[model samples]
Every structure is written in structure tokens, then in C-alpha cells.
Target: MATYVNPGSAQAGAHGTIYREVSPEQLAVEQQLVDNVVASFDACQDPRLQELMTSLVKHLHAFIREVRLTEEEWGTAIDFLTRAGHITDEVRQEFILLSDTLGASMQTINVNNQAYQGATEATVFGPFFVEDSPAIELGDDLAFGAPGEPCWVEGTVTDTDGTPLAGALIEVWEADEDGLYDVQYEAGKRAGRAHLFSAPDGGYRFWGLTPTPYPIPDDGPVGKMLDAVGR
Candidate 1:
């Protein structure tokens, strides 16, 4: 027989269980980890956190069991995540890109967001959006000397009832003709982005390059993963 102690853990039960473990008997039990964890939250302060943690534990554990994930595969996944973290910065969110590429981002939005009937639909925004963009007047060109096609856009904001909503603020940003956002340029050179307020009658207009389908950045770990998966 052997006795062991778990540092920082309090004693419990007749044998001083310390903290719960997947005992030999429990190994034969289905959903053992989920049961242990859900029962451990008796003192949980937040109801929502309890619900979230329990549900997450069950789903994540079930997924691992279903896949029978191997140790080597798990290690590779860890390496991928580590590189993704290293490559992320103030301007780049690799995790968001991961979610976006896997369609998880849109799927979550679809499940959570119910747009009002006749309301504008939402799409994935350009990752180049920077805060505190300079405001421009109607018809102002955001091109700002960036090489791109010249274009004009006009629109009016209105409620579901078709009544104009005045003084709506609008944010606009897009890639240049090269399909590179201003944030991706050297020294953070800004272009093809601006903000404007709608007119008293909810009318607005501006000049920007036409949108184009462009290849995503392929130099990071996430990009490599995408490439490996033939995305």
C-alpha cells in the first residue's frame, strides 16, 4: 500500500480522498469525468458559470471519447495552438481567423443572432478595421492615394417601417486593389477606410474601391493548417 498527498488540496471522506480521481471502478462508468466535475461545482458562485462549465465539460469530454484522440495527435494540436498564439498580435487575431475559416464564427452568430425581418444582414468584417478612424464627409474618398479603383457608394438607413433614421454613423473599410488592407502595410499606413455620419434624412455616400475576393494571409500557423487541410 502507498499513501500520497496532493499539494494544496484539502482532505475529504473516510480515506481522505483529497480530490476526486477516476478510480478503477469509475473507469468502467460512462461519463465519469463529467459526473465528477458537475458534482464538484456545488459551491459555484455563478449559476451561469456552473451551467456553462458543466455543459462544456460534457461536450468536450464526449468529443474526445468519440474521436478516441491519440496522444500524438493531441501533441500536434497543442503545437498548432502554440504557434497560433505566437503569431497573433494587436492587428491579427489568429483564433478569430481559425473560427472564421472553420465556419464556427458564422455558425455561432447564426445560432445566437436573430435579425429582425427586413433588417440588414451581417457579414464577416474585414480584419483590418482599426479603431478611431478619421471621419470623412459625404463623398470623401478613403482611397487616400492608395492605388485602387475609384468608386462611389450611396445608401440611406431606414427603420423596418421604411422611415428614414437620421444621423446614423457608418464605418467603411476595404482592401486596396492589391487586396491588402491599410493595417497590413508598413508603418501602419492607413487607406481605404473611413467613418461618416448620415445626413439629416439618413442619406450617406462615399468613394472606395470595389470589393474583391482575395486569398487570406498564408504565412502563419493557421494559414499552414488551412493549407494542409486543402482549405
Candidate 2:
């Protein structure tokens, strides 16, 4: 039997019990499986893709082995993923909900967005953002007659050095006072969302609804999972 050295334990280094109790035969078997999976990526033409695949395989295998995952648990995971895929459509994305709930979306945002002087910090773009939204001029109402108290919104687009960025596109969306985005309605209404460009002086303005708190869509499989975990 091979001694599994729990990572991050006090026995993690050279002087640990792992050096004494390790079974080379068992370790070779596990390591060879990882190596074989990694080698399958050798013919990949893209070096970056190969690297990512290899690393993913290695880490995924390690996690499975470390957790001693059971077949039943694996099957459950597959079922969850299948349900997530089935519920995803143009408007509803269960996978994005899963990622957001698990904080993976935020972690990815943090990794990709580096802090630059005087620049806006990147945030989750969210799944509700749609393409080809109606374009409006400055001071136009973004509410599009959607229900809620009218709110005036304005901002300036500028470079890191505070120089104005003329004609910069600004897109904004929000839920109405009822705490629901345009996509949540059954009628497929469009409201509380629009895009506009900055003026030559980098100034822009529009009318929108006041922000309100809303719950994430919880009728899907991800919501069930969260509920199962008592989140």
C-alpha cells in the first residue's frame, strides 16, 4: 500500500513519513496513467492548447485520486452537467450560473483583469448582456418605457491619463424596481438596457431605472444544487 501524502500537511516535505511509507509500485501505476493521458496531447498542433490540456488532465486526475471519488459520485456529477447543458439557451445559461455561484467566474475575471492606474476594475460581464442592443444618443432614455421610477444616468469615458475618449461605446443594463431584467419577462420585452457613444468631449448621459436587489434565477438545476447545499 502506498502512503498518500496529504498536500499542505506538516509531512509535506523531504523529512516526512511519505519518504518512508511510499510504495513505488503503486505510485508508478498512478503516475503512468497521468503520463499516458498527457502523452495523448503530444500531436496537438497548438503548444498552448497542449500545455493546458496536459495540465488539466494532471490536476483532474490528482483531484480524483486525492478525494477517492466513487463511481456513484462521478455519475452524479455527469448528470448534473447534463442537466446544466439541457437548460442552457439564448436567454438562460445554467452553466454561467454554476460558474458564478461557485465564484469561478470572479476568479477568472481577477486573473484576466490587472489593475492599471486610473482604469476601471473589471467586473463580471454577466450572462444577460445581449448583442446588437438598441443604440441611443446621449441623454436618451434607456428605460424604453419599462416600468419603474425614472433615473438619470451619466458618465464620462477617459483614458488612464484622464484624456477624453471620443466616441467610446458605453453599454449599460439593469433590472427595474420589480427586480428583474428584461430577459426574465415572459413577453420577451426589452427595457432598462441600451448602448451609446461618448461625445467628442468624452461625456455621455442617459435615463435608466434605479438599481434594485434581485435574486439569481433559481428554478434551474444549479439552483437546485445550491438549495441542496443550503446556500
Candidate 3:
């Protein structure tokens, strides 16, 4: 059995218990497994994809071994992810919430910001966006007959040179006063969602519910996970 030396009196060049516990032969076998797995992807013709998958495998294996992960803990993790998948449907995206809460969405945005340097920073796209939302005219009230305070918003679509970009599509959406989306309500209900086009001068305006901070929908598995973790 490997042992750790007394920390208070250990000499120079002392190594941690990790180095003492893991034999060189054991470490070699672990490394060979990582290499073999990475090598299996060599048949991939795309260089970029090959690089990404290889790096992912290497790091994922390192993390698993470094944490001394147990089978029970791994099974629990699998269960959590399975539940996350089960609760997602047409109107709910627990996975996106998981990514957002974990900061993966923000990091991805940061990494891809170079491609959108001149555009406005955007919030992570939620599942609230629906196909074939009825298009409304400029200056229309998006919150008509919907819950919450009436709000008026205006903006102009502009290019990097400050020139107006006319006819640009402007889509807007938000949670209602109760933090629920339009799709979450019963049939024929609508609130906090719409789209319109910019005017001839690139200026656009609309009336909608006032902005209010709200918690993510917590009725799903992801919400419960966040709650349990005190997020």
C-alpha cells in the first residue's frame, strides 16, 4: 500500500499520495486506454471534428479518473440526465436551462461573439419561440388582452456603420407577470411573444409587457434540479 509522508516534516521534492498510490504500470494502462479510444476516431475524415472529439475524450477520461468517480455516483448522474431528457417536449427545454445555468451557453456565446461583433448582445434563446407566430405591424401592442403592465418599446436596426437596415425582422418575447410563457397557458391564450418588421427608416416600435425579473420555469426536472442545488 502507498502512504503519504508526514506533511510537517516532508523533505524537498516530496510527492503527493496520488503519485505514491498509482504505480507506473497502472498509469500506463490508463493512458493506453485514452490513446486507444482517441485512435479509434482516426477514421473520421473531418480534421476539425476529429480534433474536437479527441480532446473531449482525453479530458473526459482525465476528469473521471481524477475524481475517482464511483459507479453509484455515475448511475445517479445518468438518472438525472435521463430525467432531463424525459421532461423536454415541444414547449419545454430543460436541457437548455441546464446549459444556461451551467454557464455553457454564455461561454459558447463568448466564443462565437466574433461572428456577431457588430450585432447587439442577445439573451440565450429559450424554447418559448414558436413557429408561425402571427406577425404584427409596427407599433402594435403585443400585450393586447395579455397579463401585466402595458409597455411600449422602440428600436432601430442598424449596420456596423450606423446606417439603418430597413425591413429587418424584429422578434420579441418575454415571460408574463407570473413567469409563464404563452404556450404554458391553456389553448387560445397568448402573452409575451410576437414579431414585427422594421420600418422604412429601420425604426420599429411595439407595446408589450413591462420587463420584470423572473425565475426560470421550475415545474420541470431541470427546475427541480436547480432548486435542489440552491441555484
lDDT of 1 by residue, 1-231 (tens): 112233454345445444334344544464566688778986899999988888787777665544455799999999999998997878777888888888988888777778888988766664556787878998899878877779889999998898988889899888888888777776467788889998988899998898876677778887898789888
**Against the true structure, what is each candidate's TM-score?**
0.82, 0.86, 0.83
Off by over 4 Å in 2: 1-3, 6-27
lDDT, candidate 3, 1-231, per-residue tens: 223233354332323324224455766787799999999999999999999999999888876665556899899889989988897777667888888888888888778776565767756675567666667999888875667888889988999788999999887888777777787775455567778999889999999998878777788777887789887
**What's each prediction's clash count?**
0, 0, 0
lDDT per model vs. reference = 0.76, 0.83, 0.76
- In candidate 3, stretches whose alpha carbon ends up further than 4 angstroms from where it belongs are 1-21, 115-119, 186-189
Choose the strongest candidate by lDDT: 2
In model 1, how large is the Cα lDDT of residue 53? 88
What is the Å distance of residue 10 in model 2 from its true position?
A: 12
Candidate of highest TM-score: 2
By TM-score, is 1 or 2 better?
2
Q: Runs in model 1 with CA error above 4 Å?
A: 1-30
Name the TM-score of candidate 2.
0.86
Looking at model 1, which ten-residue stretch has the lowest summed lDDT? 1-10
